[model samples]
Structure formats: C-alpha cells, structure tokens
Target: MSQPADYRDPRSLRSRERIIRALRAELRAGRSLTIAAVTGEAKVTRQTFYNNFDSLEEAGWFALLEDFNTLLVDDIQTRWSGASPDFVGLASLRKIVELLRAESSLSLLANGYRDEAGLTGLAAVMLSEIRRFRAEFGDPASPLAQEEDLYTATGLCGLLTVAATGDASSTSIARAAYALLPEWMRQPRL
Candidate 1:
C-alpha cells in the first residue's frame, strides 16, 4: 500500500517554515527575489528548495497568502468591531487598501510579473474571503454586486501592483478605496 503524505514530519515543516521566513525577509528588504537568494537564505540546496516548492514565486506566494489572511482578519477585528453600519463597510475597505500597501510580500505576489498560477490562487483566496464576509454580515443587494466585488478586488490588486513598483501612497490608496463605498453598498441600509 502507498503511504499517505506526512505534513507533520518535523523536517518537512522546518524546511517549509525556513523558506517562508527567507521570502518574507527578502521582500521586506526590497531585494530582488531569485531562487539562489532563497536557497542561500534558507541554507538549503537548490534541489532541496525545489523539493519544497515548485519555484521561487510559489514560495513567495505561500508566505504572502499567510500574511494577507492573518492581517485581514486581525485588522477587521481591531477596526470594525463596534463601527456604525455605514462606516463598517468603508472602514473595512480602507483597511484592506492600507494593508495591501504596507505588506511588501503581498505587493510582490500581486505584481504582474509574478507567476500567473500563484496570482490566480491569491485572487481565489480574496474572493472567498469576500464571500464569507457577505454571508456572515448579510448580502444586501447592491446595484453593483458583481462589479463592486470585482472592482474592489481589482483595485486592491492594483494598489499592491503600484506599491510593488514603488509608486503607491498609502493615504491616496486608502482614500480611493473608501471613496468607492457609497456606491458599492446597498441603499436604504440593512
């Protein structure tokens, strides 16, 4: 019989964590990412790195996705717990834009130059989170339903893209996202 995958193996977990930490450090330093840098930083051979991840982009993607999810959840809990109905949605939007702008790993992942597969995976996670939010809070029908979600996702993606290129201003990005709120939410309150 074939053996099941062993994600709990200490060596495997350590290797994965090392790779994630290396990627995070590289991104924070604003250094150009390469397989050589990752392997060297993680103290692993090229073959070892490849065994843990398909490519450098995949390594970066995993790190960024984890950071993004954690930050999103934490920011929501901290900033929106007792906010007024209208302010809640806008505050969430601003927080997202600000978070994306500040997180270099996310900015790198969303840039157009990264692996398309990784980018698509990140997009899927973002969409899933938004759906979960709607389900939990009640999805009041907005005239811009699909458009609003897509636009918000795309705008956040764009914000990260610009930040990766070193052209984004956090204040401006947050303002733009907040500005879209009135039209994105359902009228007559719910």
Candidate 2:
C-alpha cells in the first residue's frame, strides 16, 4: 500500500514559530538581524535553522507575509462590514497602505525577495481579500470585474514596490495611494 503523506509535526511547528519570534524580537531590539543572531536567539544551531528554512530571507519573507496577511484581513473585514459596497475597494486599498505604513517588516520582506514569488503571493492575497469584500457587498450594480481586479492588483504591486525600494516615506506612499483612490475604483457602471 502507498504510505500516507506525512504531516508537519508539532515540534517542527514549534521550532519554526520560535525562529520567527526570535527574528522579530531581534528586529524590535534595533539590532542588525543575521542568521547567527536569529539562531542564537532561538537557541537552535545554524544547521537546524537551515534545515527548517532555505535562507534567512525566506524565513523573513514568510513571517512578514503571514503577519501582514492576518492583520490586513482582519482590518479589511471590519472596515467592509461598516462601509457601503461602493467604498469597499478604496477602503481595502487604504487598509493595505495603512498596514504597509505601520509595519516596517513588510517593507523588509518585499525587499528581501529577488524572485517574484513574494510579490506574486502578496498580490494574490490582496486580490483574494478584495474579491471577498466585493462578494460580501453583493452589489450587482457594482460587480468586481476582471479589469478592476487587474487595476487594483497593479496598484498594490506598485505600492509594494515603492515601499520595498525605501525611496520614500510610508506616509508619502500612503498619501499618494489615497490620492489615487477615486480613479482606481471608479464606480462600476450599471
């Protein structure tokens, strides 16, 4: 008989969580984060850290993405529940920009990924959340069309790219995003 797929063990999960916690702690301490620093903080050997993650960059990206997703989703849902359907798109984008401003780690993660995987993943999550918000709105008059998705995704990708580059302050980015809100959503036709 074929063997069943092995699931992640509790210990492995615990170790990974510990590593993430340690990395965040180091970052919070205003210390330059390195693999050695994280391993030391986690009380794990370099080999163990490597065995769990291919590289510090990978771990950083995963941790930041996970954290931002949780925070962003919760904020979006709460805001959507209180706002009109017409407001969903801008509200969601504003929430994302706010998150990018508040969380410095997100910028780090975006900068860390040379490959498109991180950007693609971030875009996918944002797109999914926006779709959910639209569905919840249930406005046939303002349905989320393919073009809207494309525009929102591109705008978010641009924002993330700018944030990652660290060329401008998060406040400036947020303001720029807010300024573009009307054009981005541009209420769907009946």
Top-scoring candidate (lDDT): 2
lDDT of each: 0.58, 0.59
**Cα error, candidate 2, residue 145 (Å):** 9.7
What local lDDT score does residue 175 receive in model 1, on the 0 to 100 scale? 60
Model 1 per-residue lDDT tens digits across residues 67-86: 66675576456435554644
**Tens digits of per-residue lDDT for model 2 on 1-190?**
1111322777666777788889888877878778899999999888767767766666766665676567557655655456553455445445556666565664555346433433444565555554554454424245556557546756766776566456665555655655554342434222
Weakest 10 consecutive residues, lDDT, candidate 1? 181-190
Q: What's the CA error at residue 148 for candidate 2, in Å?
A: 8.1
* Model 2, residue 51: C-alpha shift (Å): 3.0
Best by TM-score: 1
